[model samples]
Target: MKDSFVAEDLMDLALANLAWFDGEDAGDDSGLGCNRDYRDLRGKTWADVRRVLECERRLVADFRAGEWVPDEPGDGPEVEDLELGVASVVTALSALGCIPFTSCNGRAFGGEHDADALIVGFYARPKHWRKLVDLGRGSRTELQVWDGALWLQARTTEDMLRWAERAVERAGPSASHPSLM
Candidate 1:
Protein backbone atom coordinates (compact mmCIF):
# COMPACT_ATOMS: atom_id res chain seq x y z
CA MET A 1 0.00 0.00 0.00
CA LYS A 2 1.23 3.50 -0.82
CA ASP A 3 2.15 5.73 2.12
CA SER A 4 0.58 8.82 0.71
CA PHE A 5 -2.18 10.86 2.34
CA VAL A 6 -4.68 13.28 0.82
CA ALA A 7 -7.73 15.00 2.21
CA GLU A 8 -9.91 12.91 -0.10
CA ASP A 9 -8.00 9.72 0.52
CA LEU A 10 -9.17 7.10 2.97
CA MET A 11 -7.70 8.00 6.37
CA ASP A 12 -7.19 4.38 7.24
CA LEU A 13 -9.85 2.29 5.58
CA ALA A 14 -9.67 0.01 8.62
CA LEU A 15 -10.74 2.85 10.91
CA ALA A 16 -13.55 3.77 8.56
CA ASN A 17 -14.74 0.19 8.82
CA LEU A 18 -15.02 0.54 12.58
CA ALA A 19 -17.16 3.68 12.17
CA TRP A 20 -20.23 1.47 12.12
CA PHE A 21 -19.09 -0.39 15.23
CA ASP A 22 -18.19 2.70 17.27
CA GLY A 23 -21.01 5.03 16.21
CA GLU A 24 -18.51 7.73 15.16
CA ASP A 25 -16.56 8.55 12.06
CA ALA A 26 -13.45 9.74 13.95
CA GLY A 27 -12.75 12.23 11.20
CA ASP A 28 -12.87 9.61 8.46
CA ASP A 29 -12.88 11.05 4.92
CA SER A 30 -14.22 8.06 3.02
CA GLY A 31 -16.58 10.23 1.09
CA LEU A 32 -19.65 8.91 -0.65
CA GLY A 33 -19.55 8.46 -4.40
CA CYS A 34 -21.44 10.49 -7.08
CA ASN A 35 -18.90 13.29 -7.51
CA ARG A 36 -19.35 14.71 -4.02
CA ASP A 37 -17.76 14.49 -0.57
CA TYR A 38 -20.54 13.23 1.68
CA ARG A 39 -18.62 12.12 4.75
CA ASP A 40 -19.19 14.26 7.87
CA LEU A 41 -15.50 15.17 8.18
CA ARG A 42 -15.96 18.65 6.82
CA GLY A 43 -14.93 20.70 9.87
CA LYS A 44 -12.94 18.13 11.85
CA THR A 45 -9.18 17.83 11.89
CA TRP A 46 -7.41 14.63 10.78
CA ALA A 47 -5.51 14.24 14.06
CA ASP A 48 -7.80 11.57 15.51
CA VAL A 49 -8.06 9.75 12.24
CA ARG A 50 -4.30 9.72 11.86
CA ARG A 51 -3.84 8.34 15.34
CA VAL A 52 -6.34 5.55 14.72
CA LEU A 53 -4.86 4.77 11.35
CA GLU A 54 -1.34 4.61 12.72
CA CYS A 55 -2.43 2.21 15.44
CA GLU A 56 -4.38 0.03 13.02
CA ARG A 57 -1.46 -0.02 10.61
CA ARG A 58 0.93 -1.15 13.30
CA LEU A 59 -1.38 -3.91 14.49
CA VAL A 60 -2.04 -5.15 10.98
CA ALA A 61 1.63 -5.14 10.14
CA ASP A 62 2.45 -7.01 13.32
CA PHE A 63 -0.26 -9.60 12.70
CA ARG A 64 0.96 -10.03 9.15
CA ALA A 65 4.50 -10.49 10.41
CA GLY A 66 3.46 -13.33 12.72
CA GLU A 67 4.27 -11.40 15.88
CA TRP A 68 1.16 -12.89 17.45
CA VAL A 69 0.37 -16.49 18.35
CA PRO A 70 -2.94 -18.29 18.24
CA ASP A 71 -4.92 -18.86 21.39
CA GLU A 72 -5.33 -22.32 22.91
CA PRO A 73 -8.31 -24.44 21.93
CA GLY A 74 -8.87 -26.11 25.28
CA ASP A 75 -10.26 -22.82 26.58
CA GLY A 76 -13.56 -23.59 24.93
CA PRO A 77 -16.09 -26.08 26.22
CA GLU A 78 -15.83 -29.67 25.11
CA VAL A 79 -17.92 -30.56 22.11
CA GLU A 80 -18.68 -34.26 22.18
CA ASP A 81 -22.04 -34.45 20.47
CA LEU A 82 -22.74 -35.17 16.81
CA GLU A 83 -26.28 -33.82 16.99
CA LEU A 84 -26.00 -30.08 17.70
CA GLY A 85 -28.43 -27.35 18.65
CA VAL A 86 -28.29 -23.56 18.85
CA ALA A 87 -27.54 -23.64 22.57
CA SER A 88 -24.69 -26.07 22.13
CA VAL A 89 -23.07 -24.02 19.37
CA VAL A 90 -23.47 -20.82 21.34
CA THR A 91 -22.00 -22.33 24.46
CA ALA A 92 -19.03 -23.74 22.61
CA LEU A 93 -18.17 -20.50 20.84
CA SER A 94 -18.73 -18.32 23.87
CA ALA A 95 -16.02 -20.32 25.54
CA LEU A 96 -13.65 -18.97 22.86
CA GLY A 97 -14.78 -15.38 23.63
CA CYS A 98 -16.51 -15.19 20.24
CA ILE A 99 -20.20 -14.79 20.91
CA PRO A 100 -22.51 -14.78 17.94
CA PHE A 101 -25.17 -12.07 17.88
CA THR A 102 -27.40 -13.90 15.42
CA SER A 103 -27.67 -17.56 14.47
CA CYS A 104 -29.87 -20.34 13.19
CA ASN A 105 -29.78 -24.07 13.54
CA GLY A 106 -30.90 -24.13 9.90
CA ARG A 107 -33.59 -26.50 10.98
CA ALA A 108 -36.58 -24.56 9.80
CA PHE A 109 -38.25 -27.42 8.05
CA GLY A 110 -41.56 -25.57 7.99
CA GLY A 111 -39.88 -22.20 7.40
CA GLU A 112 -36.70 -21.29 5.52
CA HIS A 113 -33.55 -23.24 4.60
CA ASP A 114 -32.76 -26.90 5.11
CA ALA A 115 -32.23 -28.77 8.33
CA ASP A 116 -29.01 -30.34 9.69
CA ALA A 117 -27.07 -27.15 9.21
CA LEU A 118 -25.72 -24.33 11.39
CA ILE A 119 -25.38 -20.67 10.53
CA VAL A 120 -23.90 -18.09 12.86
CA GLY A 121 -22.99 -14.43 12.50
CA PHE A 122 -20.29 -12.54 14.36
CA TYR A 123 -18.23 -9.37 13.98
CA ALA A 124 -14.75 -8.19 14.84
CA ARG A 125 -12.55 -5.24 14.06
CA PRO A 126 -10.83 -5.38 10.66
CA LYS A 127 -7.38 -6.15 12.04
CA HIS A 128 -8.67 -9.14 13.98
CA TRP A 129 -10.24 -10.48 10.83
CA ARG A 130 -6.82 -10.12 9.25
CA LYS A 131 -5.28 -12.18 12.02
CA LEU A 132 -7.74 -15.02 11.43
CA VAL A 133 -7.41 -14.81 7.70
CA ASP A 134 -3.64 -14.76 8.09
CA LEU A 135 -3.94 -18.07 9.87
CA GLY A 136 -6.14 -19.24 6.97
CA ARG A 137 -9.75 -18.95 8.14
CA GLY A 138 -10.87 -17.37 4.86
CA SER A 139 -11.99 -20.61 3.27
CA ARG A 140 -14.44 -21.51 6.03
CA THR A 141 -15.66 -17.92 6.20
CA GLU A 142 -18.20 -16.71 3.70
CA LEU A 143 -17.03 -14.06 1.23
CA GLN A 144 -19.93 -11.69 1.95
CA VAL A 145 -19.01 -9.22 4.67
CA TRP A 146 -21.25 -6.78 6.61
CA ASP A 147 -20.01 -4.27 9.21
CA GLY A 148 -16.82 -6.34 9.54
CA ALA A 149 -18.93 -9.30 10.50
CA LEU A 150 -18.50 -12.84 9.13
CA TRP A 151 -20.66 -15.88 8.68
CA LEU A 152 -19.84 -19.54 9.33
CA GLN A 153 -22.16 -22.04 7.74
CA ALA A 154 -21.71 -25.77 8.14
CA ARG A 155 -23.67 -28.87 7.36
CA THR A 156 -23.03 -30.42 10.75
CA THR A 157 -21.72 -29.67 14.22
CA GLU A 158 -18.52 -31.49 13.32
CA ASP A 159 -18.02 -29.21 10.37
CA MET A 160 -18.56 -26.17 12.55
CA LEU A 161 -16.06 -27.55 15.04
CA ARG A 162 -13.45 -27.88 12.32
CA TRP A 163 -13.94 -24.29 11.26
CA ALA A 164 -13.91 -23.17 14.89
CA GLU A 165 -10.67 -25.04 15.42
CA ARG A 166 -9.11 -23.16 12.54
CA ALA A 167 -10.19 -19.87 14.09
CA VAL A 168 -8.73 -20.91 17.44
CA GLU A 169 -5.46 -21.69 15.74
CA ARG A 170 -5.37 -18.14 14.41
CA ALA A 171 -6.63 -16.16 17.43
CA GLY A 172 -3.69 -14.75 19.31
CA PRO A 173 -3.03 -15.52 22.94
CA SER A 174 -3.21 -11.81 23.75
CA ALA A 175 -4.05 -8.58 22.01
CA SER A 176 -3.14 -5.07 23.03
CA HIS A 177 -6.42 -3.88 21.56
CA PRO A 178 -8.61 -6.90 21.20
CA SER A 179 -11.15 -6.61 18.41
CA LEU A 180 -14.62 -5.51 19.50
CA MET A 181 -17.39 -8.02 19.02
Candidate 2:
Protein backbone atom coordinates (compact mmCIF):
# COMPACT_ATOMS: atom_id res chain seq x y z
CA MET A 1 0.00 0.00 0.00
CA LYS A 2 1.14 3.51 -0.73
CA ASP A 3 1.75 5.80 2.21
CA SER A 4 -0.44 8.86 2.48
CA PHE A 5 1.13 12.33 2.53
CA VAL A 6 -0.20 15.87 2.37
CA ALA A 7 0.81 18.82 0.21
CA GLU A 8 2.41 20.49 3.22
CA ASP A 9 4.64 17.47 3.69
CA LEU A 10 5.72 17.68 0.08
CA MET A 11 6.36 21.41 0.36
CA ASP A 12 8.48 20.87 3.44
CA LEU A 13 10.39 18.15 1.67
CA ALA A 14 11.13 20.41 -1.34
CA LEU A 15 12.19 23.21 0.95
CA ALA A 16 14.44 20.86 2.89
CA ASN A 17 16.07 19.56 -0.27
CA LEU A 18 16.81 23.11 -1.40
CA ALA A 19 18.12 23.97 2.06
CA TRP A 20 20.40 20.93 2.02
CA PHE A 21 22.57 22.58 -0.63
CA ASP A 22 22.97 25.90 1.16
CA GLY A 23 26.16 24.88 2.94
CA GLU A 24 28.00 23.14 0.13
CA ASP A 25 30.57 24.47 -2.32
CA ALA A 26 29.95 24.75 -6.08
CA GLY A 27 32.51 21.98 -6.73
CA ASP A 28 32.64 23.21 -10.37
CA ASP A 29 31.92 26.37 -12.28
CA SER A 30 28.58 25.87 -13.95
CA GLY A 31 27.81 29.59 -13.50
CA LEU A 32 24.88 29.42 -11.07
CA GLY A 33 27.26 29.32 -8.08
CA CYS A 34 26.47 25.64 -8.24
CA ASN A 35 28.03 22.86 -10.23
CA ARG A 36 26.21 20.13 -12.13
CA ASP A 37 26.05 18.48 -8.72
CA TYR A 38 23.74 21.22 -7.40
CA ARG A 39 26.10 22.64 -4.78
CA ASP A 40 26.70 26.20 -3.62
CA LEU A 41 23.31 27.57 -4.59
CA ARG A 42 24.05 31.31 -5.24
CA GLY A 43 21.86 32.62 -2.45
CA LYS A 44 21.19 30.85 0.84
CA THR A 45 17.48 30.06 0.63
CA TRP A 46 15.32 28.12 -1.82
CA ALA A 47 13.79 31.47 -2.64
CA ASP A 48 17.11 32.48 -4.13
CA VAL A 49 17.29 29.37 -6.23
CA ARG A 50 13.82 30.06 -7.50
CA ARG A 51 14.76 33.57 -8.44
CA VAL A 52 18.05 32.66 -10.06
CA LEU A 53 16.40 29.90 -12.01
CA GLU A 54 13.78 32.36 -13.19
CA CYS A 55 11.12 30.02 -11.93
CA GLU A 56 7.59 31.27 -12.44
CA ARG A 57 6.29 32.13 -8.98
CA ARG A 58 2.76 31.24 -9.97
CA LEU A 59 3.81 27.65 -10.67
CA VAL A 60 5.06 27.30 -7.12
CA ALA A 61 1.93 29.01 -5.95
CA ASP A 62 -0.08 26.58 -8.03
CA PHE A 63 1.47 23.70 -6.16
CA ARG A 64 -0.20 24.91 -2.99
CA ALA A 65 -3.25 26.20 -4.81
CA GLY A 66 -3.72 22.64 -6.10
CA GLU A 67 -4.68 23.93 -9.53
CA TRP A 68 -2.50 23.86 -12.63
CA VAL A 69 -2.97 24.16 -16.37
CA PRO A 70 -0.47 21.80 -17.97
CA ASP A 71 1.58 22.58 -21.10
CA GLU A 72 0.57 26.20 -20.92
CA PRO A 73 4.15 27.22 -21.73
CA GLY A 74 4.69 30.12 -19.34
CA ASP A 75 2.34 28.51 -16.84
CA GLY A 76 5.06 26.12 -15.71
CA PRO A 77 8.69 26.55 -14.63
CA GLU A 78 10.95 28.06 -17.26
CA VAL A 79 12.64 25.07 -18.88
CA GLU A 80 15.53 27.03 -20.37
CA ASP A 81 16.73 27.76 -16.85
CA LEU A 82 16.02 24.27 -15.56
CA GLU A 83 17.99 21.06 -16.06
CA LEU A 84 16.71 20.57 -19.59
CA GLY A 85 13.84 18.20 -20.20
CA VAL A 86 12.86 17.18 -16.69
CA ALA A 87 11.48 20.58 -15.74
CA SER A 88 8.03 19.94 -17.16
CA VAL A 89 7.77 16.57 -15.47
CA VAL A 90 9.00 18.00 -12.19
CA THR A 91 6.58 20.86 -12.44
CA ALA A 92 3.72 18.49 -13.17
CA LEU A 93 4.63 16.26 -10.26
CA SER A 94 4.89 19.24 -7.95
CA ALA A 95 1.43 20.35 -9.03
CA LEU A 96 0.23 16.87 -8.15
CA GLY A 97 1.76 17.23 -4.66
CA CYS A 98 5.07 15.43 -5.30
CA ILE A 99 8.46 16.59 -4.08
CA PRO A 100 11.22 16.15 -6.64
CA PHE A 101 14.70 15.91 -5.17
CA THR A 102 16.76 15.12 -8.25
CA SER A 103 16.44 15.13 -12.02
CA CYS A 104 18.47 14.90 -15.20
CA ASN A 105 17.87 15.60 -18.87
CA GLY A 106 19.67 12.37 -19.77
CA ARG A 107 23.03 13.81 -20.56
CA ALA A 108 26.01 11.48 -21.01
CA PHE A 109 26.52 11.25 -17.23
CA GLY A 110 22.91 10.47 -16.45
CA GLY A 111 23.14 7.30 -14.39
CA GLU A 112 21.90 3.96 -15.76
CA HIS A 113 19.81 5.32 -18.61
CA ASP A 114 21.05 6.18 -22.06
CA ALA A 115 22.12 9.69 -23.01
CA ASP A 116 18.73 10.34 -24.57
CA ALA A 117 16.43 9.43 -21.70
CA LEU A 118 15.08 11.84 -19.09
CA ILE A 119 14.70 11.03 -15.42
CA VAL A 120 13.31 12.51 -12.21
CA GLY A 121 13.42 11.44 -8.57
CA PHE A 122 10.46 12.38 -6.41
CA TYR A 123 8.13 11.57 -3.51
CA ALA A 124 4.45 11.30 -4.36
CA ARG A 125 1.30 11.56 -2.30
CA PRO A 126 -0.91 8.51 -1.98
CA LYS A 127 -3.77 10.19 -3.75
CA HIS A 128 -1.67 10.23 -6.92
CA TRP A 129 -0.38 6.70 -6.45
CA ARG A 130 -2.63 5.07 -8.98
CA LYS A 131 -1.62 7.55 -11.65
CA LEU A 132 2.02 6.62 -11.19
CA VAL A 133 1.15 2.97 -11.64
CA ASP A 134 -0.85 3.76 -14.72
CA LEU A 135 1.97 5.83 -16.21
CA GLY A 136 4.46 3.05 -15.72
CA ARG A 137 2.06 0.61 -17.36
CA GLY A 138 1.11 2.75 -20.31
CA SER A 139 4.30 4.53 -21.22
CA ARG A 140 7.32 3.27 -23.08
CA THR A 141 9.46 4.52 -20.22
CA GLU A 142 10.26 3.00 -16.86
CA LEU A 143 9.14 4.04 -13.39
CA GLN A 144 11.05 2.33 -10.61
CA VAL A 145 10.84 2.33 -6.85
CA TRP A 146 13.79 3.74 -4.96
CA ASP A 147 14.75 3.59 -1.30
CA GLY A 148 12.54 6.45 -0.11
CA ALA A 149 11.25 7.88 -3.35
CA LEU A 150 10.36 7.00 -6.95
CA TRP A 151 12.28 7.36 -10.18
CA LEU A 152 10.79 7.91 -13.61
CA GLN A 153 12.65 7.40 -16.87
CA ALA A 154 11.40 8.55 -20.22
CA ARG A 155 13.02 7.85 -23.58
CA THR A 156 12.71 11.40 -24.82
CA THR A 157 11.60 14.87 -23.82
CA GLU A 158 8.28 14.33 -25.55
CA ASP A 159 7.74 11.14 -23.57
CA MET A 160 8.17 13.00 -20.31
CA LEU A 161 5.83 15.71 -21.53
CA ARG A 162 3.22 13.13 -22.39
CA TRP A 163 3.58 11.57 -18.96
CA ALA A 164 3.03 14.95 -17.38
CA GLU A 165 -0.07 15.54 -19.47
CA ARG A 166 -1.48 12.16 -18.53
CA ALA A 167 -0.75 12.71 -14.85
CA VAL A 168 -2.57 16.03 -14.80
CA GLU A 169 -5.48 14.50 -16.64
CA ARG A 170 -5.72 11.54 -14.31
CA ALA A 171 -5.65 13.84 -11.32
CA GLY A 172 -8.53 15.90 -12.73
CA PRO A 173 -9.19 19.28 -11.12
CA SER A 174 -6.71 20.15 -8.42
CA ALA A 175 -7.88 20.44 -4.82
CA SER A 176 -7.84 23.74 -2.95
CA HIS A 177 -4.84 25.04 -1.03
CA PRO A 178 -3.99 22.69 1.79
CA SER A 179 -4.60 25.32 4.46
CA LEU A 180 -8.06 26.08 3.17
CA MET A 181 -9.35 22.60 3.87
Candidate 3:
Protein backbone atom coordinates (compact mmCIF):
# COMPACT_ATOMS: atom_id res chain seq x y z
CA MET A 1 0.00 0.00 0.00
CA LYS A 2 1.12 3.52 -0.57
CA ASP A 3 2.45 5.39 2.43
CA SER A 4 -0.33 7.87 1.81
CA PHE A 5 -2.80 6.66 4.40
CA VAL A 6 -3.50 9.63 6.66
CA ALA A 7 -3.67 9.63 10.45
CA GLU A 8 -7.39 10.30 10.14
CA ASP A 9 -7.95 6.98 8.39
CA LEU A 10 -6.09 5.10 11.09
CA MET A 11 -8.07 6.84 13.80
CA ASP A 12 -11.30 6.03 12.02
CA LEU A 13 -10.42 2.37 11.86
CA ALA A 14 -9.48 2.32 15.50
CA LEU A 15 -12.72 4.00 16.45
CA ALA A 16 -14.67 1.66 14.24
CA ASN A 17 -13.15 -1.37 15.89
CA LEU A 18 -13.90 0.07 19.25
CA ALA A 19 -17.48 0.73 18.26
CA TRP A 20 -17.94 -2.76 16.89
CA PHE A 21 -16.69 -4.26 20.13
CA ASP A 22 -19.14 -2.14 22.06
CA GLY A 23 -22.03 -3.55 20.00
CA GLU A 24 -22.82 -0.24 18.37
CA ASP A 25 -23.35 0.75 14.79
CA ALA A 26 -20.32 2.59 13.45
CA GLY A 27 -22.52 5.20 11.81
CA ASP A 28 -24.91 5.89 14.63
CA ASP A 29 -22.70 5.68 17.70
CA SER A 30 -19.69 7.89 17.96
CA GLY A 31 -16.52 6.63 19.68
CA LEU A 32 -16.72 9.34 22.29
CA GLY A 33 -17.47 6.97 25.15
CA CYS A 34 -15.01 4.33 23.97
CA ASN A 35 -12.60 5.10 26.76
CA ARG A 36 -15.06 5.12 29.63
CA ASP A 37 -13.32 2.31 31.40
CA TYR A 38 -10.38 4.47 32.29
CA ARG A 39 -8.86 2.15 34.86
CA ASP A 40 -8.43 -0.50 32.20
CA LEU A 41 -9.06 1.51 29.08
CA ARG A 42 -6.59 -0.45 27.01
CA GLY A 43 -7.55 -3.47 29.07
CA LYS A 44 -9.40 -5.11 26.23
CA THR A 45 -9.74 -8.83 26.19
CA TRP A 46 -6.37 -10.38 25.40
CA ALA A 47 -7.79 -11.93 22.26
CA ASP A 48 -9.17 -8.63 20.97
CA VAL A 49 -5.99 -6.72 21.73
CA ARG A 50 -3.97 -9.49 20.08
CA ARG A 51 -6.09 -9.20 16.97
CA VAL A 52 -5.37 -5.48 16.74
CA LEU A 53 -1.67 -6.01 17.35
CA GLU A 54 -1.56 -8.75 14.75
CA CYS A 55 -3.24 -6.48 12.24
CA GLU A 56 -0.61 -3.86 12.98
CA ARG A 57 2.13 -6.35 12.09
CA ARG A 58 0.56 -7.23 8.76
CA LEU A 59 -0.03 -3.56 7.94
CA VAL A 60 3.64 -2.78 8.51
CA ALA A 61 4.78 -5.66 6.32
CA ASP A 62 2.40 -4.69 3.54
CA PHE A 63 3.37 -1.01 3.75
CA ARG A 64 7.04 -1.94 3.59
CA ALA A 65 6.35 -4.13 0.56
CA GLY A 66 4.18 -1.46 -1.00
CA GLU A 67 1.37 -3.96 -1.34
CA TRP A 68 -1.08 -2.76 1.25
CA VAL A 69 -4.60 -2.11 -0.06
CA PRO A 70 -7.77 -0.75 1.50
CA ASP A 71 -10.48 -3.24 2.30
CA GLU A 72 -13.26 -1.46 0.49
CA PRO A 73 -15.21 -4.36 -1.05
CA GLY A 74 -16.09 -3.23 -4.58
CA ASP A 75 -13.91 -0.16 -4.53
CA GLY A 76 -10.72 -2.03 -3.64
CA PRO A 77 -9.40 -5.25 -2.09
CA GLU A 78 -11.13 -6.87 0.85
CA VAL A 79 -9.49 -6.71 4.26
CA GLU A 80 -10.06 -10.44 4.69
CA ASP A 81 -7.75 -11.04 1.72
CA LEU A 82 -5.10 -8.66 3.00
CA GLU A 83 -4.24 -10.57 6.16
CA LEU A 84 -4.35 -8.30 9.21
CA GLY A 85 -4.95 -5.05 7.41
CA VAL A 86 -6.37 -3.35 10.49
CA ALA A 87 -3.45 -4.24 12.68
CA SER A 88 -1.07 -3.51 9.86
CA VAL A 89 -2.31 0.06 9.64
CA VAL A 90 -1.78 0.58 13.34
CA THR A 91 1.68 -0.97 13.17
CA ALA A 92 2.57 1.16 10.18
CA LEU A 93 1.64 4.36 12.04
CA SER A 94 3.67 3.31 15.06
CA ALA A 95 6.55 2.47 12.76
CA LEU A 96 6.26 5.92 11.27
CA GLY A 97 6.83 7.28 14.79
CA CYS A 98 3.22 8.02 15.81
CA ILE A 99 3.13 7.74 19.54
CA PRO A 100 0.73 5.19 21.10
CA PHE A 101 -0.63 6.04 24.51
CA THR A 102 -3.41 4.52 26.60
CA SER A 103 -5.22 5.35 29.80
CA CYS A 104 -3.50 2.40 31.44
CA ASN A 105 -0.32 4.35 31.30
CA GLY A 106 0.15 7.90 32.50
CA ARG A 107 0.15 9.31 28.96
CA ALA A 108 -3.17 11.16 29.39
CA PHE A 109 -4.41 13.64 31.96
CA GLY A 110 -7.96 14.91 32.59
CA GLY A 111 -9.45 18.32 33.35
CA GLU A 112 -12.32 20.71 32.52
CA HIS A 113 -12.73 23.77 30.25
CA ASP A 114 -10.60 25.28 27.48
CA ALA A 115 -8.02 26.39 29.94
CA ASP A 116 -7.56 22.73 30.82
CA ALA A 117 -4.58 21.31 29.02
CA LEU A 118 -4.43 17.90 27.45
CA ILE A 119 -1.18 16.55 28.90
CA VAL A 120 0.71 13.56 27.59
CA GLY A 121 3.00 11.72 29.92
CA PHE A 122 6.60 11.02 29.00
CA TYR A 123 9.06 8.37 30.09
CA ALA A 124 11.14 9.16 33.16
CA ARG A 125 11.48 8.28 36.84
CA PRO A 126 8.31 10.26 37.47
CA LYS A 127 6.55 10.50 34.14
CA HIS A 128 5.32 13.96 33.26
CA TRP A 129 2.23 15.05 31.35
CA ARG A 130 3.06 17.76 28.81
CA LYS A 131 0.36 20.38 28.24
CA LEU A 132 -1.20 20.38 24.79
CA VAL A 133 -3.32 23.49 24.96
CA ASP A 134 -2.25 24.59 21.52
CA LEU A 135 -3.52 21.41 19.89
CA GLY A 136 -7.12 22.51 20.20
CA ARG A 137 -6.26 26.10 19.45
CA GLY A 138 -8.65 28.08 17.21
CA SER A 139 -11.29 25.38 17.53
CA ARG A 140 -14.47 25.43 19.55
CA THR A 141 -14.17 21.70 20.03
CA GLU A 142 -13.04 20.42 23.36
CA LEU A 143 -10.60 17.55 23.46
CA GLN A 144 -11.80 15.17 26.12
CA VAL A 145 -9.40 13.83 28.72
CA TRP A 146 -11.11 11.54 31.19
CA ASP A 147 -9.08 9.98 33.94
CA GLY A 148 -5.98 9.66 31.78
CA ALA A 149 -7.94 8.79 28.66
CA LEU A 150 -7.69 11.25 25.81
CA TRP A 151 -9.99 11.38 22.81
CA LEU A 152 -11.15 14.11 20.47
CA GLN A 153 -14.66 14.53 19.16
CA ALA A 154 -13.55 14.25 15.58
CA ARG A 155 -15.74 12.85 12.82
CA THR A 156 -13.54 13.39 9.81
CA THR A 157 -10.09 12.27 8.76
CA GLU A 158 -8.75 15.81 8.89
CA ASP A 159 -9.82 16.21 12.48
CA MET A 160 -8.21 12.96 13.51
CA LEU A 161 -4.97 13.82 11.72
CA ARG A 162 -4.77 17.10 13.55
CA TRP A 163 -5.27 15.33 16.86
CA ALA A 164 -2.76 12.62 16.02
CA GLU A 165 -0.15 15.15 15.00
CA ARG A 166 -0.55 16.92 18.28
CA ALA A 167 -0.41 13.62 20.13
CA VAL A 168 2.80 12.53 18.40
CA GLU A 169 4.34 15.87 19.11
CA ARG A 170 3.34 15.62 22.75
CA ALA A 171 4.81 12.14 23.07
CA GLY A 172 8.24 13.45 22.05
CA PRO A 173 11.24 11.04 22.05
CA SER A 174 9.75 8.69 24.60
CA ALA A 175 9.73 4.95 23.95
CA SER A 176 5.94 5.16 23.70
CA HIS A 177 6.32 7.04 20.43
CA PRO A 178 5.58 4.89 17.41
CA SER A 179 8.60 3.40 15.63
CA LEU A 180 9.06 2.35 12.02
CA MET A 181 9.91 -1.31 12.22
Best by TM-score: 2
Candidate 2 residue-wise lDDT, 101-132, digit = tens? 56776752233333455788765554555556
Error of 1 at 16 (Å): 3.4
Query: Mind giving the per-residue lDDT tens digits that candidate 1 earns over 52-159?
Result: 333433443453476743354212211221122233333333333333445555642112433435666544444444443432233333322455555445554344
* TM-score between model 3 and native: 0.26
lDDT of 2 at 49: 26
Model 2, runs deviating above 4 Å: 1-80, 108-116, 171-181
C-alpha root-mean-square deviation, candidate 1: 17.2
Q: What TM-score number comes out for model 2?
A: 0.47
Error of 1 at 117 (Å): 4.4
Per-model CA lDDT versus the true structure: 0.37, 0.48, 0.30
Better of 1 and 2 by lDDT: 2
- For the record, the alpha-carbon RMSD of candidate 2 to the native fold, in angstroms, is 12.4
